[model samples]
Target: METLVKLFKNNIRQYGMIIALVVIMILFEMITGGLLLKPINITNLILQNSYILVLAIGMVLVIITGHIDLSVGSIAAFVGAVAAIMMVDLHWHPVVAVIASLVVGALIGAWQGFWVAYVKIPAFIVTLAGMLLFRGLTMIVLKGQSIAPFPNGFQKISSGFIPDFGSAGTNIVAVLAGILFTVIYIVNELRDRRAQKKYNFEVVSGGLFILKLVVIAAIINAFTFMLAIYAGLPNILILLLVLIIIYSFVMNKTVMGRHIYALGGNEKAADLSGVKTKKVTFWVFVNMGVLAAISGLIFAARLNAATPRAGTNFELDAIAASFIGGASATGGIGTVFGAIIGGLVMGVLNNGMSLIGLGVDWQQGIKGLVLLAAVAFDIYNKKKVTFLK
Candidate 1:
């Protein structure tokens, strides 16, 4: 019992946000008369928030490097515009267009990165300039008009679902996938716990550990069951899962990830320690640019059109998601999983408010409060930890 309490106390921020998410879901579920968690609505929530979540993944890393990218929204718009021009006007294949779009995104990132990393300009200024530059370019390329009817292959990237192998009801594949994921999660947790024990690291008691596993396993199965009943799993969801796994591994297990944290925590100190601060910083922006492009493509596919207004305020959402997910304003702290949770928090708020007939004005106000509270909570925890130390 004491060990469990200690563990929870040490991880209050991570655990608290998760608990808060559950509470929010339950509140909306009841208020919306069970509409919030309806399988269809759940799927819609994932689809609608998919792009922002992608941006958040990249944004977290940027924040961890003590930087921000304000141009991501405009870059996304520009990339989408370029993609539309290629596919719709130039008659290029979707695969070719996607590759071309990603390359364009990389070039854009390199441009901004040069200013920020090599020229010593602040990221905020560079990205703000980029935001304006790309937005204007998007308008020019699109000629202030919308392009529609993307190829079926492009559309499927955002709207398609995994094929169901089951009979006329639930999706058997989804259920089996859920079960497989649960088993893997459990195995990983147990393995980690064993490693910790071997290293004499503090761990929760056996009873508490088992309880935690059961709860998580239950949540996973329940979520997958919901998807199994309604339209199966989205292709975007699979993409998101893959991204989460890969990024989590990169951030937690790789040397480059450590250098990024060190850079954010103290740039000069990191440089003295032989970390290639400039190169790391430059690559971080490049990565963000690529993710923003991915987001643009996804958003364009979802709308089935590329428009001048495609990525408005997207940068704000990504930044907010990173902060709300527990990325320190000063950098050096955060997780990919945390960013996803933060994005989901925003997504649920948007979905729940719309369901209850709340106006956009109210939705905005509520989300602002949530963002403020999340940051305040982070600051409070930091202060407490500092005081204790």
Candidate 2:
């Protein structure tokens, strides 16, 4: 029992939020007559929140580096508008338009990064200026009008499903994918455990380890079953998975990731230790811009339109997600997986509230309260840790 408590305390940031997510899901499942977890609604939840989730991924990185970006929403909007004009008005190929949009996003990132990193401007002020600048640019580009009916191939970025390679009451592709992923996950976990043991690191008890593997495997299989029953897997889901895997690897197994954390943890100390603080900070913002652009493209693809209001308040959602996912306000503490989980929690909340027929205003209020609670919890945990020390 003491060991369990110790474990919980050590991993409270992760376990706490995961438990909260599960509890919230179960509560909503009961209240909404299981509508919250319906396959179609689940798919819609993924579709609706994918862009915000993408932003959260980038936002978490920015926050970890002890900075904020108020410009991502506008960046998304601007890029979407630009892409629309390229594809619809200029008759540019969809692929070319996407590539161009991403490039534009990178340039925007570079602009902001230059100000923050080289000019030593506070990220808040630089991004705030960018927010207004890009938003106005979005309106100017669209001339305050919305563009629509994107080419089918372009729209597929958000709405397309994976191809069905097997038939099991419509398709077995998702199920197969689920099984494959589960196997990979288990193997990885075991390999990690073996490596830890070989290095004489403390390892969880075998029983506890098995329990975690089982629970995670069950979740993966169940989620994939739901997808298999409905639309196989979304193309956007694939994109998200790829991004998560890539980002997670970068964060966990790469030098740049260490530099980011080091810079965030203590910029002065990192610089003293010979870290390229300016270059790292600059690249982080550039990455954020590229992600924001991708998000914009996805949003535009999903709606089949690019509007002046396309990315309104997206930065807020992403920031909220990053915080709720256990990012420390002071920086140097977060994970790509945590950001994803936080986004899912918000997605589920939105879906559940809408299913229960709640008004948008109420939904916003509830979400704000949830975000506050999450931050409060983080602070409380920090205080406890400090007191213990």
Candidate 3:
């Protein structure tokens, strides 16, 4: 019992956010007359937030390195505009346009990264400049016009659903996928426990571990079931899942990932320990740029148009998701899963508020308050831990 209590206390930041998400979801479901999680609405929820979630994944890495990217929104807009020009005006194939856009994003990242990593400029100043520069470029590319009606192939990237193989309106694939995910999760947890025991590291109590597994399994199955009932699965959701798995593996199991954390934790010490801080910083921004480009493409595909104001305020949303997901302001903390939860929290809020007929003005204010509260809670928790120590 004491061990369980200690575990809960230690992980309050992680677990609290999840509990808050569930409570908020339930509250919204009730208030919205059961519209919040309806099949179609659930599908829309994933589609609407997919881009922000992509941004959140990249943003978490940036914040983990004790830096920020104020330019992702602009970069995404710029890339989307470039893609529009290539695909629509130039008549380039969708695949070629996508490749070109991602390349452009990388070059842009390299440009800003050179300043931040090698020139020793503050990331804040560099990214802020990038934000303005890219937004201006987006305007120039679009020439104050919206580019629309993308090729059918491109639209499918964001709007298409997985084909169902089962008859009678049943989505067997989604159900199987959910079961597979749960089994894999349980296996991983047990394996991790064994490894920890082998290395003489502390492990969670068996009962607590089992309870955790059950809760997570239930959530996963429930989510998949909802999607199965609606449209099986979305293509964008599949992309998001793949990215999450890859990034979670990178952060947890790779040497570079450890270096990043160390660099954020103590740059000078990490450098002294032979970590390539400059290279790490450079690559992180480069990676962020690539992700932003992908996000831009996804957003563009969803709308089937590229507009001048496509990514307005996107930076704020991504940043809020990262911080609200339990990322420390000082860096060297946070998880990919946490970032997803944070993005979902914001997504649900936006969706629920819209259903309740809240105006954009009220929505913005409420979101601002939520972001502020999340950061305040993080600060308070950090201080409390320091005091206890």
**CA lDDT of each prediction against the hidden true structure:** 0.92, 0.94, 0.93
The true-versus-predicted C-alpha distance at residue 358 of model 3, in Å, is: 1.4
> Candidate 1 lDDT (Cα, whole model)?
0.92
Looking at model 2, report the run of 10 residues with the lowest lDDT sum.
Answer: 165-174
Cα lDDT tens digits for candidate 1, 1-389: 77777877877767777887889899999999999999999999999999999999999999999998999999999999999999988989999999999999999988998899999999999998999999999999888999988999999989999998778899998899899999999999999999999999988888888999999999999999999999899999999999999999999999999999999999999999999999999999999999999999999999999999989999988988888888888888888999998888889989999999999999989989998998898899899989999
Tens digits of lDDT, candidate 2, 81-109: 99999999999999999999999999999
**Candidate 1 ranges with C-alpha deviation above 4 Å:** none
Report how far off residue 254 is in candidate 2 (Å): 0.6
Cα-based TM-score, every candidate? 0.98, 0.98, 0.98
24 in model 2: Cα distance from truth in Å? 0.7
